[model samples]
Target: MRSAITLEPVVVTAPMQTSPLRVVLDPKRPYQPVPASDGADFLKSIPGFDTIRKGGSNGDPVFRGMVGSRLNILVDGGQIGGGCPSRMDPPTAYIAPELFDKVTLIKGPETVTWGPGNSAGTVLFDRTFTRYEKPSWSFIGSLLGGTRGRFDQTADIRAGTPDFYMGVSANHTRADDYEDGSGHRVHSSYERWNTDVTLGWTPGKDTRVELTAGRGNGHAAYAFSGMDGVQFLRQSLALHFVQENLSETFTKLDVRAYYNSVDHVMDNYTLRRPDPDSAMPMAMASEPARQTRGGRVAGTFDWGDAVELVAGIDGSGNTHTSRSGGPEGSIMGYYRDMPRRRDATISTVGGFSQLTWYLNTHQRLIGGTRVDWAHVRGYALTGDGDSGSLSMGSGMGMGGSAPETTAASRSATLPSGFLRYEHDLADTHATLYAGIGHVERFPDYWEMFGGHVASTVTSFQSLRPERTTQLDVGVQYQTQRTQAWVSAYAGVVNDYILIHYLDGNGAASNVNARIMGGEAGVVRAIGSHWKGNATVAYAWGQNQTEHRPLPQLPPLDVKLGLVYDAGRWSAGALWRVDSAQHRIAIGEGNIVGDDLGPTGGFGVFSVNGSMRLSQEFTLSAGVDNLFDKTYAESVNAISKELQGYTGAIRINEPGRTFWAKLEVKL
Candidate 1:
């Protein structure tokens, strides 16, 4: 094993960013969110990042050109479930921005540094303890408000010395129905809260021990779903130890163990008051919850001169359970969770290692692989042992294990690998790089129970793993007044997972689609105080065999922005235009939302400003959907409509609004 070495990208990773604002969700940079919605919602402000729109919150982001299980999302090293089955409660929604220190995103399948099947790269939201050269204290806070009675508040405080440290943080967020371009009020409302605490000890110069505990809960209304104000509750605890500056031969060492539990509830009992004509048929409720508890141990080593290696293992099992007796219109006891709640603890274990070598001053290479082993056990749910939704195909508490099909009574092994090469230009600040990768992902819970077909990757197999073989290449350049990057990739996927659906005959159908495309972006600093960023991307994938455009392939799009940063103040403007997308299928979807519906091209504009008030305090604010454009990112459900669109395409965006943030360091 070698010592741990620093590996950081020169520029920040964003979703085909056509704006100067970097992706705040990326773990490498520190981002403070004052908005009161789930974390992923904040990401939509970036270019090339869109969602399966249903009018309101809980929209799952599609980055670059990948979505669903293709993207690996983790928080404080924990894998949290996205509460909304249609992804209204994306994993980021379950996390509070005030709880963590930084967010990181690695775009594309250029590396295999994270866990299993992240063919779309990895996203990590991390937390780090505060350290002081001497005894010190600090506070960070933010407030936000917008149209439709929207508002949010957050606060974090930390105090400590080199020998001992402690910190705490919390937040509250709420919103009401909003009107789209058509002046139609949307029922997108939610309320959430979070709190965290950590105590640390620095016994000597290079060692530290820490203990952590926290709890969070919230409820939200969805225009895309039939229910409202679904409840979200969670509690978690963790223990960690760290040792740095060990020796030149062993640069750094770290170990962490954690246990977390979530008690989520979804019901119309809170927001849906009995209104005869308001689409209320009695009531809908579900208290289903998914609980996942696990622990991990990892280490990093750096080999002197030219090599660095990282290896570690993690294991965790999750289970789902619920009980409900309600009206036919009510999906009571139907708590939406990752991998539909069955009476079983699906367990997974995996290990990984990566080695980077400096072949020469002009070249480098990274090679690594990861293997995951999982055991899934579940039984059918027969409605209090009396009658059941078996006829509805929703019973998940009775079926026995498929021993012969699974590797270990209910388990299987997954593996992925990657390789890369790079070179720097002579007498210039530029680099050219390319790589090839092979990645595989075991079917996710949504891809299983949520899927109407027997298999997504195979003809009849039950959710066979999705595999992708990709080739990636790109270039970057920087000058005193200009910066630019152009990335292009092409890959042929085997068993490419595609979706299918129908609504009358003209409703678009995504037959067997194979997808392939590329993205490009650039920013030039104009003369003295002006900076401009622009990007254009086009992707097309389809059931190559079916000869149809891939369902939901991002349409031809363009983004442009201008920024002026000077001393303690920065101001910027953002504008985006997207071509209409007619390609779509009604059903094939991941847990959150699905398919393409009819859409017309539209444009949106926004403005933002930030200022450093003092050495210790900084303030920032921005207005999203500046022009209050009305558009549907994509359909949440083709067979139905969220709130109302006459048909199924729900094209609703927020009206003109304002948001603000404040940060303090002491």
Candidate 2:
């Protein structure tokens, strides 16, 4: 990526990108009134996005009503996978957004430069190194306190000279179980901390090399799942190199290598008492570990000033292993004694190229293509003969039945591409664009290990790659005082992979499906001191094979915001509303969960204020769910238990909560 700096406030009103629906966020900004526990919470502040909340943090993110591999997420250009088969720890769960410099979201399969199978879109959290003109040092720190014993602290420090630099960032956050609007406490408490360090060397004016390392560990309580995350430990390392202006035609060359590992432990005994009547009659614990390694090499070529090309090859490999023990005391730490078993290994290698043709100043054309080779191997490590053994590719890891496994290997070669045309109305400060993209996604480890064995072969061998063909269109309008944008997509998926639960049994299968969605927003500068903005998003889907509405489809949602800004003071109010959802396919869903019948929708309101005390100090505060209204989101998973209600009920959101924050820069 080209390196450049732009000074602007971190806000939702930034100018639109060349790609439709793409949003680039500045993580250092104060636009989000609430403190985000992780990257997922930060995404929730954007329009057209929603999360499947398990509790206060680690909620699964949904874009255009799509989840999982559909949304390819990367941190510092590397992928990180959690060990939990239940997705108790999603990729974002390990990411502390504040530590990153930028978060970019490319909605849909509009480009092929990243990795493969981003049919839903792509999310990138990046931290870029800045060269110092002279010897310098800087620091940023923040402290937060809120209701429910909520508290957080963060610090970032940097010191460097003209040719070298180093920095470190760290944060800690925790919260207790919060009461609902109805005055009932839910099982949602968590504590987390992370620290990252970076070192950089610039040998030449146009060359740079950087190294990064980080470690984090924490535990979180779950309100809807059988087991709580007793431990979430992560370690990461990466090296990146960039050479700009390598030549006139070959303008840039970039390469990177990274390693990430996660150690996770889950147990009912540690966070809650064992349910004697349940299958796990006594305290039990499951420890899982995943290791991922990957690298990418890319270069940019330019032909004159009107045409440019970016080509690259990227590959990644990951292995999953686990150990478990049952019916032990809460203090036993059974994971250490349980036998460790390697269950699965997955890998992918891909090559891609993207081209841009600038046809005059008013029009442009862009195209991209990618090909990937993916492989998966698995084993029945226990040979337990228990068809009910939980496995990664099997259906039972989340909310389904245990999966039977067998030693197996599978491989697939898939191709994907897209073409787009963009037109600019310079005089009117408006732009219009349209594109069509196709992506073939291989079955992930969880999908393979989560499915039941079919025939004499393991389900991992029978599952096919999901194919998505999509068309996207959008328009953006901007002026001195007003900005607006709208984007839409329609797609037909062949061999779409879906899981179903029937009669207490879960199975994975392939089917034909259709999906469509769009998001639109408008921001108007109201006078000099006030601004107003509104946005709306909606998604729809259908199961062609089942002749029913697709499951896990999110309801139409909207947001309205008004902000007032003075020299040193600013305040804002936000209102969010969602329509009720009645369309759902019972017993059918993805790895997350099946549709829980119909759900009612509600609206929420919040207020925020901030003061810029000086160049080095600032303060902010807010009240979320201001009315303390009891409500549940339309796109939600089943709660294991909620406010005395059980059996597939949606988890309630936190009631009226207040928080304050103080920030300092030196």
Candidate 3:
């Protein structure tokens, strides 16, 4: 037999689109700007993706200028919801990208295979399970160290027989406050850890049964908020079953069920001392929690080589509760002893069907439809008499006279669907596609219950479901030496939820809006040992009702990269630039935060390299912001007047930094 051969994968600088409106990423490969600490940080390397920077980690992710529930995020086909009312911990906060095998991103409302209301897009972080031919074992591990006391460790080990398998993975990361280019320290520090275990049984070549459990906890300091995230605890459990090649027509069946919960605590004492002049000057803490349970079942059917169909039903429900206490060493100082108050309960059930018809080898048509029933019941603290004013501690960030108890409930039937056509140019190695999609999204907990209403004391009964109708068009081209893709979308939002902040108080209202954006990228080989790549992304939005520009939209951004590969080692450099944003809606924005004002543009450069030490080990290192440039992203959180932080209105990015990593496989 001939000797086995293998090829090393190149270090990824910018993710290239695999198809129209879709991008696939390899989580195991080394990337520039050091290894990521969380999923949001890793996603930022891709075009058209940005984060609401609040600190060193746990920043909320934004896609195409949209944040919050508009973008659906999933891990192992399961959903995890954060418990912070202020959105300090987004769904991506609990995700450690290094522990997964693959990351798939589908932009726009192009499919209904996942859950409902993904108007922005869908992200799936998946793990692949393999069956052994005989008794076998595998191991993969990594260690990382960086500036400002940054350190990370990860390990994955698996051993299995032909019929049985077991695996476990864990990671830990921490960092201290980082200084800006001017040598001023920002109040940003964090620590996090997570562990997961899996067990599986493979009775036959075409069947699989698996169970998984995970737990994680962490804490992060914030410069934009009055209180820091002192505790973030997560617990999850899931079951999966799959059967393939059942029959000629019944190709496959897949089923999944999961449960997830988040217990979060925020305080001014755990991470830092209370600012003497700030609100709530004494030690205080609030504990908020959420529990989510859901499941999905789908079947795939194929008819010869002409057509295929997939049908599925999915549903999920969740509840939110909170308790608070303040002033250490005094009566009622411990929040743990306070009785938890149930505030909101929400649920959704949906059914979907998707089909693909191969008109010919070069042309195809794809379509899908889904309908969802959503409901919500909110408990509000109401004042006496006819004023209808809410009381303090109502979880609406409002204060009023002593209140009476009240409840409100709302329900809606939503419909969504999409249709697309694709044509492959014969012998040209290119494909062109166009599609249109529509989605109706219900208001989330933060939009309906976290703030006051425009005309009422509360928003629970006044907000309306948002509807989006969009058209997407794109093209893909690939050759022996180059790859390129471009995609664009335009949509109209009816009854769009908008948050307004005035005089330190927040209110929610409905308005009509229009949004448009596009992203393009190209990668080309220059010679035997060199390569070049570039990407650009931009988004624009307007509040049609008021004829003003939408708030919190990211500015035009661009990235350029160059690399040189020698047989055993490689080096790369990246330069990122952003254009100044003058559009402003001031007090109006999303749930995370509102725009401060116009932001000046800036650029930064970084470099990285890697070398194979041996067959089992490899080392990589990089320096970010090599020039120590101090700049803030246009979509960053507004900074508060903290005791020690004297930065600009927005939280600034870290100064010049360095990181190194070591990997081993066995």
Candidate 4:
């Protein structure tokens, strides 16, 4: 007779923290609400994370109320930048989470092993390759279908031997316009696809060399802007070399280099008809592109068994170019033939060293420091007789003024560091930690070249570096049947870059601000067959200079889930609520959009289930917004008037949705 075995229920609502201030998620697992179509969609399932929804896809992610460059995103140890001046495509827009093996998030400035300027946090999407002792092959794939014509397919295949290995990953996703709870259709449709290839060579058990290449493209319709993203194209390449067991004290040596590029296009007529009464009454389109290249070399060392160290040097550079055409029927594709003009360039070089010291059996210390030198140069043309002056009142055009070419440049040297102490309970499975970190951030492309200064003709020469000092504290506990964690942070920002929108133009300025936030979660086993979990996140900010609430902050949000597991199948329910946000800074926000006004509170309910059909196959399905409630996020963009659609000041979420997914491994 054969014996019967039971399997633990899979997490479907939200992932739990594995350690203090750190969360590691398996990208291959199925999640609630809906299967992710992009990186931002996957992040929304975590506490202390939100998205600035623009459409069905390509939304920018915000962590702890910080957006843009404050949140650093790395894919396979490389950085990629978007090209759109209006932020139609963020760094996350180029990432397809399903292709990665693991996603790790480090909340707050707790560590600085990666690059600089990560004031809010750091997120890494990584892929791991195992050495094959003999000839072997593996395959993993999934197919998903849902309401509103949503369909997706993904596949990963690998074959390897002791000395050589190769693997390929690819995915495609598409969705049609979805209706809101009010039975009105929103202009939110999109299609995207990506493919990546990896090759590795292993000469011995301690040495390895690998190379990766990828390409992706997509199009999305937006309900919050006048133009739609007609194209989001990306290309990437990276190489890595690693050697272990070099000597007794020198543990390892690692080196990496990467190149990434993004080419984007936006048009008013491709995805939707141009509003007859809007600013651009005729057909219009713009194309912008950026190229980024960087490299890093680091070594790991151990001093006996008490201390360990990692030191490295890294550098990167990027250039931006754009072109536009419109207002004339005879020049429909003029942008395609026009030459791309380079408007801005940025470069940076930095060196860092981090160490871990084991003081005792129950206590430890960690710290690191880094210094970076940054340079930026911007080009503009104007008729005001002011050399190195540019007008960003409208689009990338010259504002119908005579062209007089000019340029300006600036440089800065900044320093950053962090220290943390951790204590492990001697009698219990728990850990408590406290950390303090400081970072100095150079203004990015948007703050320097995409906006204007209130007091000067350009912001490139006037904007100053931003400095942040923050403290983070957290506790984590785990047992066989229960897991719990809580984390909090408070920070002060000097020369905080604040963007103001007026008369359809954006202006940038510096100010002082204070920010505080926290997140907590717990998962407990009620019985052999039942489990319960809950999580809460909240953030608040104040503009010290203006003595008022900061704009674009997310409200208090909570999530509750219950699951029942029977040997071969499992079912779960999830309830989410968001508190009303009364704080307002009407016209102040980030690069994507400005806040319109206050928002009311709302709640949503969803249910999900999964079944193992066989040893190699699993199926899952879910229904979101069970009550068909109409709601919008507090940190959302203002809606733009379309030709035939009427919407509120902010874009609303989708109505009741149904989806299902199937997976197989061999």
- What ranges in model 1 sit over 4 Å off? 1-36, 83-86, 245-248, 274-280, 326-341, 381-409, 451-461, 499-513, 566-568, 616-619, 635-641
- Misplaced by over 4 Å in model 3 are 1-10, 381-405, 451-458
Model 4: how far residue 152 lies from native, Å: 0.5
- Candidate 3 CA-lDDT value: 0.84
Which rank order by TM-score, best down to worst? 4, 3, 2, 1
lDDT of 4 by residue, 1-666 (tens): 855447566546968878878999988888887988999999989899999988899988999988888988999888899887667888999998989999999887776778879999999999999778999999999999998999999999999998989999999999999888787888899999999999999888888899999999989998877788999899999999999989999998999999999999988888887777876666788888999999889999999889999999988899999888763453545667768888888999999999999998888899999999999887763323332222222234433553565777889998999999999998898999999999999988877666332323355677789899999999999999999999999999999888887765567888899999999999999988999999999999999998888889999999999999997899999999999999879988876667788899999999999988888898899999989999989997645664226547777888899999999999
Per-residue error (Å), model 1, residue 327: 10
The TM-score measured for candidate 2 stands at 0.94
TM-score to true structure, per model? 0.84, 0.94, 0.96, 0.96
Tens-place lDDT per residue, model 2, 357-417, is 9999899899999999998888752233344533322222333444454677878999999
- Steric clashes per prediction: 33, 11, 0, 0
Against the correct fold, how does model 4 do in TM-score? Answer: 0.96
The residue pairs in collision within model 4 are none
Q: What is the lDDT of residue 335 in candidate 1?
A: 33
Q: For each candidate, what is the lDDT?
A: 0.61, 0.81, 0.84, 0.85
lDDT at position 582, candidate 3: 98
**Model 1: worst 10 consecutive residues (lDDT sum):** 384-393
lDDT of 2 at 143: 88
